[model samples]
Target: MIYKYFKECKKLIVLITLLGMLIGMLFFITKDTPPTLVLKKKKINIEYGQTYYANFKGLVDTTGMSKKEICYLKKNVSITDNLQNEDQKSYPAVGKYKIFIKYNNKLSTIQIICKDTLAPVLAFPKNVDVIKESDLESIDFKSLIIATDLSPLKEIQIDTSQIDIHRIGEYQVKVFVEDIYKNRREKEFKVNVTENKQETTNSQNNQENNVNKIESENNKPNEDITISQSNEKNNVKDHLDNGHQQTKPPQMVYWYECYLCGLYVDSNVSLEDAKKKFDQTKCTDAIEFSGIEWRHSRFHYGINHS
Candidate 1:
């Protein structure tokens, strides 16, 4: 009986020892710690041409390791900070980049985004002149605009709705442009529409008519020179030799000037009929005035010019 009791006691002692070892293993695991690093900022932003430095102010856990242990861990860790490439150092292009930080078998990330906030430089013309009937395609719009932007230019828009190319007047042309980042710029310029050749000719004719009217009043003949129709026919041949004859015989037509445009209109029909004919055809700009002067050419019937 004593022998059997001693065997049972031995088994009980072995069970207590195994239980104590299991508890000790659990305590050792609980006391173990992990290396850690905490960062104050994980993301940063900067301008395209601004300077950047790779720096981190954070807490690093060295709970159960010495400086040598940490140094060894750092050697195994890989750090890649490609914020500034070779090209970026010279000319920084706007973009986003990531910094990879790996230490103590742990991974952390940093984000950097570059932006362009400055306004673009502009070189624009102050004024431009174009004829009223000028063609739009003939204008070199691109050459007139000189602009530079940090961000790429997306598009340029021109607004010419207020300018009438068919009318003689001053108008405004607005130019607008935008960058890739939605940065916008605008400029305005004056556009002058000048008269065409036909209009210039009309102005010159008006001046001549004014001069002729003043001369006719100043030089009144002392007596009217009478010549018979048969005698006039005989002198017609003589007038032709003196370059005082009409190359094409004059037709019996009403000759007058448009009061609105001051352009002379001559027709074989009556004054009213001439106005209607000009209205039906685009003989000149749409007439705004109806007053007409009944006049005849001074060169008619071989009247020599002084």
Candidate 2:
């Protein structure tokens, strides 16, 4: 009975040993099979300051692996950028980087390209109103242009071929610019050209008529003041029934013109005083004119019978 019990125990021990050997052989054969890591793409591009999600879909079968092994493989994967100054989290510069992943003593490299994503903003000034054929000699586009960008501007191009200063109408002016990252922007504006000569002449004539009307009301036959619209000097003769010759003091007429203002003034007062009076009476708005013209004429007063 003791021999029978020992035989049974021996058979049980042999069976257990055979099972352990078979398991060991199976594990060794499976280990010889290489691990697989498949990716959707070998390279990827992302804009600067963009977020990346680690949704790696192609992880090999972790079925028979322990949780510790899977965690170790995932943790070994890292992404690094080639930019010099910025941190790894925020890729501030444009360059190429590598995404390296290590699993099962294998290294997989993926290309990651960083690029600029922001577009440039362009702004234009208020509409430009200029005289026809007068101030067209210079066009300062820099003053009217307002541009901003995250990167340096590559170029600014202006197209003014449609603007014809000689024509009395509104035209379009187009502008375009680009940034370092190939981002583009464009703007269009209007340039108005109108006839100002007719307006100025009519305004001058009206002012002259007003001055003449005022002088006519104040002047009398014996002591009259006459103003002529002639380019040359005129002599005023004073006649007396007594035939006695008496010379009257010379009368001074001063002319004032401001290019910005269409009003003209002629008076016998000093230049400073004349300007002050003109500013008070006509230039109530006190708007500044760009240019000025002044002239003075000396003549004697004439008596008119009419």
Which has the greatest lDDT?
Answer: 1
Task: Name the TM-score of candidate 2.
Answer: 0.48
lDDT by residue for model 1 (53-119), tens: 4432122344566676566545555546677633524324688887777876678888878787755
lDDT per residue (tens digit) for residues 153-192 in model 2: 9768888888788887877889888888888887887766
| Candidate 1: residue 208 lDDT (0-100) | 78
- The 10 consecutive residues of candidate 2 with the worst lDDT sum are 297-306
Best by TM-score: 2
The Cα RMSD in angstroms, rounded to one decimal, for candidate 2 relative to the true structure is 26.9
lDDT of each: 0.54, 0.53
Clashing pairs in 1: none
> Which stretches of model 1 miss by more than 4 angstroms?
1-38, 56-80, 86-92, 100-107, 116-120, 180-182, 196-306
